[model samples]
Target chain A: MRGAVLHAPGDVRVEQLEDPRVVEPTDAVVRASATCVCGSDLWPYRGINEVTEPTPIGHEYCGIVEEVGSDVTTVRPGQFVIVPFIASDGTCAHCRAGYQSACAHRVGVTGAQAELLRVPHADGTLVATPEVPSAELLPSLLTLSDVMATGWFAAVAAGVQPGMTVAVVGDGAVGLLGVLSAAQLGAERIIAMSRHEPRQRLATGFGATDIVTERGDEGVARIRDLTDGVGADAVLECVGTGESMDQAIRSTRPGGGVGFVGVPHGVEITGRQLFSTMVRLHGGPAPVRRFLPDLIDRVWSGTIDPGRVFDLTLPLDQAAEGYRAMDERRAVKALLTP
Target chain B: MRGAVLHAPGDVRVEQLEDPRVVEPTDAVVRASATCVCGSDLWPYRGINEVTEPTPIGHEYCGIVEEVGSDVTTVRPGQFVIVPFIASDGTCAHCRAGYQSACAHRVGVTGAQAELLRVPHADGTLVATPEVPSAELLPSLLTLSDVMATGWFAAVAAGVQPGMTVAVVGDGAVGLLGVLSAAQLGAERIIAMSRHEPRQRLATGFGATDIVTERGDEGVARIRDLTDGVGADAVLECVGTGESMDQAIRSTRPGGGVGFVGVPHGVEITGRQLFSTMVRLHGGPAPVRRFLPDLIDRVWSGTIDPGRVFDLTLPLDQAAEGYRAMDERRAVKALLTP
Candidate 1:
């Protein structure tokens, strides 16, 4: 099997690797239909997060099940499935509470940017589509594995309600999708903060009622102005940087909520700061597994077109280019055909 | 009129002062029926909070409206009222949204221990009881001014629900009342963390099903053991110190909530910590005004007895002794009658 590996900072290569197999009773081997480069993937690629060794990369994928272990019951071979970024037992307390990302016995899916990937806890982590979705549905379906579901979780965690004024920070795929999620949640208005014209256009298409190109203090002020100095009722922090988190918190009204889904890099919040604002804070690595079924439905029904976030595509052999495109800011997200 | 003044740290004195009169057209002068020493009062009395001058002290009070400014309509002369610690214009966006403590045009009430007190935003800051209550009901009713209401806010912000496991992390007046609040909210099991025997007894009486005397990591571990290692569904942080806040955050289950009502003193939380735990954080000064009417009914109906937290009662002239008892930890709380 051919798979992508991170050899060093700024170096990704597609090379021949040992084929994956169902090694555990709860495991399954999935033949990748589609995968993508995640923004988080850039951390190590950019020399920020440590690259300890040539590691298996990518956690997002949609695939067709090739083989299932003897203990597998919920799913079997030949079915199309969305592989959630985090694998859970489904019966754990956290999983039962709809926070599968914090599942007691959790496994992270990797090497998804390959022809075949072994998935642990298959019965609990893989959500089979109603039927084998067509090739065109792959991009959107694959996103249910992480980014899109994460955006939806941000909205849910922020407590975005109908008639709410929501603000979203960051212009990456997750933030753009957050605009879409807030819209789907019936937010009356969405203020997308972006400095790039293309991303602003995408945000608009995702149902952003307004776009503010300013950032930091100016960005918060713009949102406050738009909301009549009350700040947004809900703000989604899609970027994990300290600046983005601070902006999101400041742009929310008292008693409002800030749902932060970005993996934090250098964020530090004082208790006094949070207490003074009277804002609700809730977020983390999204429990994407919980939203896979419903999001797949939305994509299947054409209620949303999250696949549009994939502005670039590459063949499996050209996986390095996918990382380069996203790293150099040339693509919002890059879809890989396996 | 006579009011208590903090001449300096550890030096409180009841001294003669000019009578308070209706100042703002929206203000009212209340003849004090009762006021009390709050947990926060100890902060200044113990020299933790700077006291540069002889400042009027006390922010909690319940009394009869002696006079009302022309614009004061909701509360009027001769009406018995509960004055929330913070005064807010009910029409502000925050107040309308039930966050009166964050009201746009807010005022902090001071010198409530005086014979007469002037309250701004009378219509918004005061909740008049159904009628003049009997003498024995004063303590419980006075608690609606701050401690009891603050505790209720803690439980509410933590999202306590019927049948959920709740934990209260402070044995002060507010923490004891938090146990009562959790019970009133229908939590199936309430854990009170306290080392003090009297406080534990009071906590149990307030519907705490369990008591854990451990502190820090040991305390969190005990809570986890009590909840079958899942941690409490909702944890109320009634102590503001960094250690207490961290303990509260650590004791909550993933996807659970921590409602911190204690004013944070030196609390610092890194984003990585919050991201890893997936704990929801929400809190601030209690918006006591918002819960006044409902709490008053509970007090009036004998549904709750928050006044039990006050272990000492003193005449208004002995306000200094009230401060002394509380500062020395000799009394859980002190009630002062004019």
Candidate 2:
């Protein structure tokens, strides 16, 4: 099997690796159909996070289940499925409470940028669609495994409602998808904060009612101006830097909500500002499994085409080019076919 | 008229001040029958907050309406009423959404600890009782003006549910009242974190199912141990400090909600920790006006006695003693009569 591996910071390669097998009773072997480079992948690729050795490097994919362990029940061999990045035992108390990301028995599926990947807790982690989706819908359904579901979680956490104003602070695939999620949730106005032309176009296509090409304080000011000087009813922070968090906080109306989905770097929220502004903060690793089933359906039905984010594509052997394109900001998202 | 004035930090006195008069067409002047010192008042008196000049102090009171401006239609002269600390016009979109504290035309009622106080937006800010209450119930009903209502907001914001566990971080009058609020909201397990004997007794009387005297990490450990290592379903943070904020965050279950009511001081929330934990943070100034009607009824019916928090009482002229006792930690709360 061939997979993308990171040997060190700034060193990524697609090379032959040992094929994955179902090592546990609840595991399933997935033959990857399509995978993509994530914004989060840039963290280790850019040397911001330490890479000790050659490690499997992908967590998003839509694939066909090639094999399943004895305990797997919901998904069977040969079924096309969307696998949530976080695998959970779905019956755990946390999973029952709709927090599958924090499931008591959870495993993270890494190295999906490969020909085959092992998925743990298969019954709870994989959402099987009625059939194998068309090639055109494959990329979008793949996104439902992570980015799209994450965007949906951000919108849900922020409590986006009909006739409400929502601001999204990050221009990546997840942030662009957030506009779609907010629209689906009935938000009347969706503000996309971005300066990139491709991302701006994608955001608009995904139902952004407005766009502010500013950053930080300037961006917040623009949102407030658009909201009649009262900031947005809900803000989705998809970039995890201090500036992004600050903009998200400042862009929210008093008594509003800020839902953050970005893996934070060094941001911190002051108590005084948090209480004085009276904004509710809710976010974290999204419960992607909770939305996988419905999102896959939406993608299959052509209700949403999140694959539009993939402006670049390559074969699995050229995974390095996919990562480089995203890292250099040359593409919104890069799709890799294994 | 006489009012409690803070000449500077540590110097509170009952002194003559100009009699309050209606300044807005929708304003109403009320003659205070009773006013109480709030836990927040001691922030300046204890030198935590700098007092620049003779600031009119206090924000909790129950009184008889002395006069109503021409535009005041809901509340009238001769009516007994409880004034919410925040005066909202009740007509703004925010107020219509039940967030009266963030009302578009909201104003703070200063000098509530006075013989007479001018309340702005009287129609929406003051809730009148059916009849004048007896002397014994006056103290409890007066609490509905701020602390009691604030505590109720904490419980509501935390989404305390029947059979769920709740942890309160502060043991002040508001925190003690938070226990009662949680009980009223049907939280089955209310854990009040307190080291002081008096506060512990008060918390237990207010329906605290357990008490933990440890602070910070130790307190979090105790809470986790009690909840079988999962932490509380809801946490009410009534103390606004870095330590209290950390404790609240650490004590909540993943995906649980933390409702903070304390005016934040130097606390900060890291985006990474918040996202990883999947906790929901919600709070701000209590929309006390929204809960005034029901709280007044609860007090009048003797279903709740928030006045039990007032361990000490003095005449209006002895305002200095009231401040000193609270500042020195001798009393949880102090009541004053004119």
Candidate closest to the true structure, highest lDDT: 1
**Candidate 1 C-alpha error for residue A299, in Å:** 0.9
DockQ of 1: 0.89
Using TM-score as the measure, the top candidate is 1
Report the backbone clash tally of model 2: 1
Model 2 per-residue lDDT at B262: 94
Error of 2 at A35 (Å): 0.8
DockQ of each: 0.89, 0.77
Give the range of the ten consecutive residues with the poorest summed lDDT in model 1 chain B.
Answer: B69-78
What does the lDDT read for residue A53 in candidate 2? Answer: 83
Candidate 2, residues A1-338: lDDT per residue as tens digits? 99999988778899999999999999999998999999999999999989988898999988999999998899899899888899999998788888999888888879989999899999988999999877888888888888998899999998899998999999999999999999998999999999988788889999998989999778878997998777899999988899998899999987788988999999988887877777889999989988877787787778888888889989989988888899999988899998
Please give the CA lDDT of all the candidate structures. Answer: 0.94, 0.90
Model 2 C-alpha lDDT per residue in residues B175-195, reported as the tens digit of each score: 999999999989999999999
Per-residue lDDT of candidate 1, residues B9-62 (tens digit): 999999999998888899999999999999998888889999999999999999
